[model samples]
Target: MTVTIGFVGAGGIAEWQHFDIVEARDDVEVAGICDVNQAAASEAAERFDATAYTDHEKLYDGEDLDAVFVCIPPFAHGPAEIAAAERGIDLFVEKPLALSVDRAREIHQAIDAADVLAGVGYDWRYSRGVERAQELLDGRTVATIEGRWWGGVPGDDGHWWREFEKSGGQIVEQATHVYDTVRLLAGDVEAVSGAGSHRLVDAVDFADSTSVTMEHESGAISHVSTTCAAEDHDAHLEVVADGATLRITEEEITGTVDGEDIEESFDVNPYAVEVDAFVEAVAAGDPSPIRSTYDDAFDTFALTMAANEALDADGRVQPAAIDDGTDAGEADQ
Candidate 1:
């Protein structure tokens, strides 16, 4: 049976990463498209030969979709996700689930009660470089993990991403891929301490450079720093384990493994892999193969939110403090 999918947002990521991939699939039909920008939605619908709607409620009510991809900005997350869950339609949501923890938890509760298949857009996990890195780190004790995202801010000065209230800053908006990868390789973050400052970019209200230190539940240590004011640098992760070091980029993984120099390159498109996995999972009614589920991505979001809170407090804070779960206490040690 062919699965009919609708897109709730027709932004860049939705158009390039998601719609393009799903459009290439033979067993899936692009049923509808929706965006706040009617022109954009109409354009996408024209390309796919699907109906267009300016509001998501109209799209949901008009299209009998098996799944919907919610690719809106961080601040515009809750409604589409909740609506899809309520309608028993599976969902593939973009990263940084919501701008605030409370709203994310509310959406989580709704999704949990509905029990529909759900996936998040942490496509980096499906990269062959990450796969190889995971394989190499399996039996080794990871000592220190360091990751960084150094680049210019996305979009123009008027973009929503530049506003902290709209995008949740660079940490939650852009650096989330690195944070999620760190959590995947290391483990759940127990506590985070960090500092941020608006050094260069005057266009955005948020910080231009931010540094965060995380303590994982498995006793691994990680430091992730991001800057939107610099020239493009390879945003990647380097893991130092017992007698081995692994450096992972989006396209390649290189380093020493057991005193032997090893390098591997990835030609696979992770976005395609991620989309295929979600489609297959929905077809089989089992979401087991999806790397980043809504709940798992929420943990990453909570960690980023905690880092932002720590920056505000000028001290360390536990991830639990932001999520209203068990108290992991302050990171004052």
Candidate 2:
């Protein structure tokens, strides 16, 4: 069966990651393309032999899509996902689900009620190096995990990502990949205490640096620190396990095992792997292979939001305690 897919956002991610991966598949067809920018949608539609619309409603109503990929920004979520779920269309959403927890909860409800297959864009979980690291650390006692996303600010001047309100700050918008990886390696976070500062990048209001200490349900301690002030270092997760230490970056995992040096590199593109997993799951009618479902991504979302809350309170906060009018904590049970 040919899977007809529609794209709700035709930005860089769609052009570079989703489009390239989906276009290569023989079992899928680009059915429609929609974006708030009409030109972008039209260009993408022309390239893929699909229809273009500035409004997602028109695209959904006019096209018979089996799945819809929502690649919009943090602030542009909610309605598209809800509409797709209402139409019983499978969904693939990009990370940092929404600008607010309430919006994420609404999408969650729609997906749950529809019982449709859904996947989120925590693509790092699909990295071969991360998989190898997971295999090496499995059944081992983890002591501590340290994750960081230290780098210079991304995007050009006046980009939406530099805005706190629109992009949900760097922690939510950029550093979330690291947060998700930490959760995957460590476990579900129980509580967080952190502080944020807007000391750098005067043109943007979002914090340039944030430091948070997390307590996981597995009784392991972890800390994730992020900064958009430096471009000289690498972004990675370092896990300290019993008798060994593993450092996992986007391209490789390096460390020592049993007092011997061991290093593994990844040649596979995680974005491609992620897209393939979503397509295969949709085709097979099983979402089990999806490492990051909307529900699971919500946990990462909550954890980051909790860190933001703590930054505001100048104290500690439980991730499950920040109520968004949904039972987000139920996933822990």
Candidate 3:
């Protein structure tokens, strides 16, 4: 069965990752493309032979979509997501769910009430290397978890990401992949403490270099550091467990398990894997195949937001609590 898909944003990661992946799949049809930029939306629409619209509401109203990929920036998140959820359309959202925690919470509530299947773009969770790291660390005590995303300032779609208010800084905006992968390998973070410096980037007041320490609920300690100062790009997560030490990067997993050396290279494309997973789940009428569901990714958002708070306060901050909406509704009743 062909899963009909709509795109909420048509540039940068949307085109580079999602557009190409879905367009290559025979069982997936690109039904509509919507972006604030008319030229971008129209170009993508023309290429895919899909309809183009400037507003997501119009796309949602006009097209019979099985799922919509909400790829807008962090600040432009709420409206598209809420509208889609209200219409009972499944969603695949790109991460750092929103610039504000309250906005993310609201979107989460909408998805829950509508009973829609939603996936977040924490594509690293689907990496073969990450899976290998999980297998190696299973049934073992994880001691220290370390992750890093060292890279240059991103300028893909536009300069919107360079602004703090729009992008939520480097930790929340770009390195969130590291944070999500850390949570996947270690556990949910109970508290976040971090420090950052904005001396490097003049364009934004937020940090250009950041280091976050996360205390997992399981009593494990994890540290993730990010910097947009370097010219080279590197991202990876390393975990030290009872009997194994595993390092997972986008391309491979390498380290020692049971005092034996191990190395595994992955040729897999995580973007394709994640997209395929979402499409399959949409077709199967089950979201279990998606590794990063909306609520699950929200936890990662809360963690990063806590890190942001920690940076400003110079103290540990617990992640903002989120309810599944069941108890809150009953309380109101």
Candidate 4:
């Protein structure tokens, strides 16, 4: 059966990852494209032989879609996912989930009530290196975890990412991959304390240098650092297990595991793999192929949110203690 799909955001990620991956598959068809920018929507629609709309409601009304990709920005997450779930259309949402934890929880509840298949774009989870790392660390006891996301500012000086309100700072908007990967490697975090500085980047209001210390429920300690003042981009997650150290970068995983030397590299595109998984799950009428569902992604978002809260209170904050007016503690449960 051909899976008819619609795109709710025709921006960079939609074109580069979701659109290209789905276009390559003969079992799927791009039915419609939506963007607040009419030109972008029209251009993407013409390129993919689909219809374009500036409003997502119209796209949903006009198309017979099995699923839709919610590729909007960090702050623009709620309405599209809720509307699609209400229509019983499956969702493939991009990361960060939302700017607020309460909003993300509502979206999660909506999807659960609708009982539709959902996937989040935590694409790093789909990498071959991650698969191997899980295999190698299957039953091992983890010690200290180190995660880093050091990079220069993204987009232009006036880009939305520069604004903390819009992007949720560097940790939430970009380094979430590092946070999520570490959570996958080590267990859930029990408490978090963070410090941040905003001295370098004049246009950005948020912290340019941020460091977080997490106390894991597994009795393990984690230190995650991120900065937007660097000239080069460098990001990685390293897990120091008993007698083994495994490091995961975007292109490869290298280190010693199980008392043996190991170095594995992957040139594969995780974005394409994740999009393919979402499409395949939709086509097969199953959700098991998706590695990161909305609920799972919410845990990661909560962790970042806790870090932000920690920075605010200048004290250690439990992920469950966030002031989003909900039982955020249940997110980890």
Candidate 5:
């Protein structure tokens, strides 16, 4: 089946993840491209041989697309998702689904009410090593999960990513992958406390470096840190589940346990496997493991937001739940 696809943003993600997977797949087709800038849309449309539009509504309304990928910045997400879900279009929205918890829940309701297949692009959840680690760590008592994502901050390159309202600082903009992956390995975060600073980057007003401690309802302790200060970019996710430790460093994983030395060294390319999974889910009507379901993504996003809140005030933020009402507790069973 040919799955028609529309996109709300045609910047980095479109050039990278969306184009690579959607265009490569025999079952997927690029139906329309939308961007606030006509030039960008046109360039992407020509490159992909798809139609482009300056306004998202035209792309959304004119085409009978199967799914829409909302790769717009965080601030643009709420409006984009509202339109897609209302149209009953299956959606593949990128991570940090929204800048705030309230907007996240609103999108959740719209998608659920529309009875659409909705998923968020928490891309790291699709990594091969990440999947292996989750299997090893599942049904085990996880002790600690530590992660660090450091790189030079993205400057204003005519993108909304430079704006705080759009990106929510580096924490929400970039570190959300680490945040979401930690939750996937550990569990739902309960309490958050920490500190952050704007000592490095001149682009954003808020902190470009943040460190936080989270206590999960599973009693697993996690240490999360992110910064745009390092000279070279790096990513790492390490989980200590009981006596076993599974780690993936800035570029790869090393070490072994139980005769399985699961290691995969790789370049940090922008393309992702999660996009394929989302598209496949749209085709098959079956949900993927890391669907970034409304509740799951919001919990991680709220935890990240609350971590920032606690850091700014030097206090503990508790009951990290969803509902756009600041009711930070676990989701309903």
Candidate 6:
């Protein structure tokens, strides 16, 4: 059986993460595409010989697609997602879920009230290095971990990402991947302390860069410093346990045991893996390996929002004050 998939956005990451992978899969077919920008949707349709539309209702109501990929902006997610859920179409949406908790809750409610599968584009979790890191750290006495992701703003996307109000700054729009990765590898986040500056963009609600400190419940420490001000930018994760260390870069993961070094290149393009996983999940009736499921996705949003709140509070954003069910509270007694 083949899975008919409709793609809703046709841009950089959409192309990078979905188009390339789905095009190569025999079990998946690009059935339709919808973009408010008809030309963009037509471009994707032309490549797959599928239908294109400016209205998503055409895809949901008219087409025979079994699932939909919602790759629109953070703020543009809820309606498309609810549409898919109402139609019982499995969905794969891009990360950070939404710009606010209320919106995420709405989408999550739609998803939970339906009989469909859903996944988010947290591609990092599908990466081989990140998976290996998760595997190696299991049952070990973890001490400290930190992740950093820095890169330039998307001038390629017409600079739409520079607006903090739209993108939710670096935390919601970008480092969300890192935030989710750390929590998956470390533990439940207890509190968030944030610091950010408008060093690069002017009159934008989003920061050009930010630094966040995360306190986890498992007694492990984690810190994150994210910036988009540099050219040779990507991401890296470092973890320490019993004085030993494990570090994962974008393409490589390194582990040192007793001061002996071990490292290798990992081949997974988390984007490709995520697309494949979503299709398989829809077919087999399961969630994915790298899902930013609304539950976890909302947690990521909450943590980052709390971090932003912390920065707004002059770094006094204590754990007790954050109302988002993300921070650590009195663990016992």
Candidate closest to the true structure, highest lDDT: 1
Indicate which candidate wins on TM-score. 1
Tens digits of per-residue lDDT, candidate 1, 139-188, equal: 88888899998888788868999898899998999899999999999988
Q: What's each prediction's TM-score?
A: 0.96, 0.95, 0.95, 0.95, 0.91, 0.91
Predicted candidate 5 versus true structure: per-residue lDDT over 1-333, tens digit per residue: 888898888987777667877777888888889999899999889877899898877888999988998888788778788888898888888777887777888888898889888887776776665666766766778889998888886755645666777788778878888988888877888787788887877766677788988888888999889888789988888887765777864345665656667666666532456776777788887776335776678887887787767666545677456653774432321
State the local distance difference test value for candidate 6: 0.78
Model 1 CA lDDT for position 110: 83
Candidate 6, residue 239: how far the Cα is off, in Å:
0.7
Note each model's CA RMSD in angstroms: 1.7, 2.8, 4.1, 2.7, 3.3, 3.2
| Model 5 poorest 10 in a row by lDDT | 324-333
Query: Which stretch of 10 consecutive residues in model 1 shows the poorest summed lDDT?
Result: 320-329
How good is model 5 by TM-score? 0.91
Count of clashes, each model: 0, 0, 0, 0, 3, 3
Write down the lDDT that model 2 would get: 0.87
Candidate 3 Cα outliers beyond 4 Å, as residue runs: 156-158, 324-333
Error of 2 at 143 (Å): 0.7
* lDDT of every predicted structure (CA atoms): 0.89, 0.87, 0.88, 0.87, 0.78, 0.78
Model 2 residue runs over 4 Å out of place are: 321-333
| lDDT (Cα, tens digit) per residue for candidate 3, span 1-333 | 999999999987898988889988999999999999999999999989999999999999999999999999888999999999999999999998998778899999999999999999998888888888877888999998999999887785458888888999888898899999888877898777778887876756678888888889888999999988888999988889998988889789889899899988989999999999999999999998999999999888888887887776645677876774321111110
Q: Which 10 consecutive residues of model 4 have the lowest summed lDDT? A: 324-333
Pairs that clash in candidate 4: none
Instruction: Give the Å shift of residue 232 in candidate 4.
Output: 0.8
Measured with C-alpha atoms, the lDDT of residue 97 in candidate 4 is 92
